[model samples]
Target: MNPIVYAIPIFFLMILIEVITTIIRKKDYYRVNDAINSLSTGMLNVTTGVIFKLGIYTLIYNHIALFSFDGNALWVWVLGFLLQDFFYYWNHRKGHEVNILWASHSVHHQSEEYNLTTALRQTSTSFLFSWIFYVPMATLGIPPHIFLTVSLLNLLYQYWVHTRHIPKLGWFEYVLVTPSNHRVHHAKNRKYLDKNYGGVFILWDRLFGTFIEEDENYEAIRYGTLKTLRSWNPVWANFHLYTEMLRDAIKTKSWKDKLTLWFRRTGYRPVDVATPMKMPDIHAYENYNPEASKGLKVYSLFQFAILVLATTVFMTISHNTPYGFNLLWTIVLALNLIGTGWLLEKYTGLIAVEAIRFVLSGATIFVSNGIWINLIPTWAWQFIIVSGAVSLLVLQASGIAKPGSNREGNTVRAAGS
Candidate 1:
């Protein structure tokens, strides 16, 4: 069973509580746009993982484990958990220190606001290299099942540390990756950058000298990368760094710098192509907060709810469903996530993307002789149909639609457009 499936309800429930508490206290920690955008990235990560991760992980583990030790000792679980965290610390630290890895890992750190949803801001491409870090465990003869469970445990342990509501733990601060310690990891301050890389245990960082305690004297810890993403788009959040790398790789005169720039230290540029790109003064930089109308927000929420429902069914029944249908809906869900971000940013052509989404939802439900229809009650379907119809009317009146009439605007593909 996927650990995250069990945690999905708890995630939303905790997020709801966080939103309420922040509102009651009048704290600016939770933003509707940012939270939803983070969830969108997470949605993409899981939906795409079904295609990319499962087969690769199983194949690699099986090949490496035929001669592997089958340790069922109680200590194996505990030892496996500890060993996984040790590797995770380095994998995560190098993800920050290395250029190519940061291109994938930086997506999680790009959120300006620290909240529960920030935990869900995951990378779609990081798995490309992350799996290699665990090959030692496979060879050491730790059972692949143990490695898999421990990996999930290590991941789930880090989720709570993403919150701002928790203060430093007294003695646990020395051993575990407490919220205060992890906050420094996410901070962009020169002092905070590349610190506290532990996923579950702070012991590794303390021993390795990457630990940094939160300093009230320095400045308030700001959440995000030094080079801000400056947009709400999740797809761009994943690929923007790669695109920059590729663009730099194309422009550099020296083939050495062109090829090595990716593997070289992050932010390295050939002197010819490098210009003075200023990091925003932290004190003066403002968070991205585009104004989305109430109607649009409601429409986005409705679409997201339906997406969540579809995703849940697919994950539960993926082995039983047709592979083609699974891939189609997954890609559709990913595109709607992009559209969700565009709608929040008030970008061009959101209306058309959303119009296409509504059509897909209706078609998916009515086709296959009510395949999706059986997932819910008839009354619920009637309500969704009425609400979806009203949503289309609202989208037409929202004035965000006019751009769809233009060929260029309709096809605009870049982030922050």
Candidate 2:
């Protein structure tokens, strides 16, 4: 079983505890749409990883690993853990310093509010090059299972640090990455930018001169990128930076810049491309929260709950299913995420879009007479078809099916305006 599959219930349980604590303390740490968006991107990241990730590490270990060590040795496990975190520090640091890398990494930093949900908001595209950073483990002959265990440990360690509720631990703050130091890493404040890049240990940042402490009096740390993603669309969140880079790359007159701009510093723009005349005041920034009604929130959650279940099913069955089936299922889930985002944004036109999706999904399964029959059970297909019909009726009964009803903005504006 995937270690993450076991961690899934624990993740939700901890998040539930955080939600209850925030409510009791009146700290207002979560927004419904924001939390949902964070989880949506996370599901997208994990599902896409299953569909697209290749077994480079295992293959390399089998073929060209220079040193062989016993997979069961205690020293090997300790060394693997240390090496994983060491490389993770550089991988994370370079993610912020380089433009193309930042394009993918920026998804993790898109949310203005930091919490446990924020920890899951990962990038789907990091697999493109992030594997290069850990190839040394494979070359050093660390068993793939040990490499995986250490990697999961590094990831799980970072999750709890995303919360503001945890104060600095007295001694742990210096050795390990604590909430205090990790908060500095997420801040947009000029002094805090690109600081504290460690995963489990803070020593790497200290050694590299990238460490900065959370000050008592300097200023309240402002979270998020200088350029905020003001929308809740998860697919758009992943591509927004890439879109900007591509535009700049296309517009530049200099061939060198067109080719090398992605390798340059984060937020680099070619000379010919015009920078925005005005930028947001980082000190006075407001979160990108569009108002949503109670009904809309419920509807969005309903869809999100279903997607979560579907994602869990995908993760469980992906290894046993054909690669093509996995890819197709991933696309359906991604589109479902986009639809859910539209609903959260209060796009009144989403009724038509979602209705079409439900109908198409039902019809596809009905016509194919059990697509994924070997993997997904027949009852699951019936449930999907039934859910589609039920959702349509719910929309109609709630009057949300009416076009332009309770709309925050026109459909075009809701999308990106």
Candidate 3:
């Protein structure tokens, strides 16, 4: 069973508790559009992972493992956990240092707000290369189950540290990763830019000289990337950096730079394509919090709830489904997320995308003879159809389908409009 299946409910419960805490404290920490956008990226990552998860680790373990260890041994479990953490530290650090890797890892830091949802903002493409870092555990004969368990545990450990409500721990700060340490990791301030890369333990950062304390008195930490992702489209968020890098590679005069630019340091740019751009004042920056109508917000929340349920269904049954069905389902889910983002951003002409999604969803059921996703009962699919139809009618009635609904002073237009 996927460990994330069990943690899904707990993740939402903690978010609910944090929401209440922030409300009682009268702090403006959560924004509906930003939270939903963060979650959209997460769903994209999860679904993509489900379809593309490789088995090279198990193959290597079976064929080339140096030594076999007893899976049930206590010490073996401890070793596996430590190994996963060590690998995660380097994977995360290199993710920030390398240009191509940063293209994938930056999704986690694109959010302008620091909240629990920010932890869910992940990259869909990191799986392409991240597994290379963990191959040593497989080669050393760590059982696949143990490695998987430790990985899930390490991931769950990092989730809680994304919140702002938690303060600095005293002695615990010196040992394990805490909220304070991770908040510094997500900040764009000069001092906190690439600090605190540990997943579960802060000792690695301290030992490796990457640790930096969160001193709010010296300068209030501003969140997000230096090149802000001003749009709420999750699909665009994942590919924007890659697109920029590709454009740079094409524009550079040197063939060596063109072929090797992605492997170079994070901020490296070719001399020919390097244009001096003004850096934003991090201390006085504002978040990309755009104006959203209450009706649109409610509609987005309702649609997101449906997507969450659909994602649960996807995760539950994807392992047993055929590759073709999984690929089709992944495409559908990606489009659903994109449409949700469009609604949240109040992007005009969403009706066209919704029409495509509606058609694909209907075909997913009909082409598979209504048995493609067995977890979703027939009644549930009917309910979704009814709900989507009603939503479309209501959206059209509210003028959301009109071309000028996203005019200035009313709603924020989509990026590049």
Worst 10-residue lDDT window for candidate 2 reads 408-417
Candidate 3 global TM-score:
0.93
Error of 3 at 60 (Å): 2.1
What digit string (tens of lDDT, one per residue) describes model 1 on residues 1-417? 346787888888888898898888777787677788888888888877777654444566667654555468878778788889999988898898778999999999888788889998899997788977877766566777788889988888888888877877899999899888888888877677789999999999999899889775677777888787877678899999999989888998999988898888777777779874555566566666666655566767876777777677667766566665567667767776777777777646666766776676566555533554354345645765786677767778866445532222111111111
Candidate closer to the true structure by TM-score (higher is better), 1 or 2: 2
Q: Mind giving the per-residue lDDT tens digits that candidate 2 earns over 340-372?
A: 888877646766878878876666556444565
Clashing pairs in 3: none
Candidate 2 at residue 271, lDDT?
A: 74
CA lDDT, every prediction? Answer: 0.76, 0.84, 0.84
| lDDT for residue 310 in candidate 3, whole number 0-100 | 83
**TM-score, structure 2 vs. true:** 0.93
Question: Cα RMSDs of all predictions?
Answer: 5.2, 3.7, 3.5
Error of 2 at 105 (Å): 0.6
- List TM-score per model, in order: 0.88, 0.93, 0.93
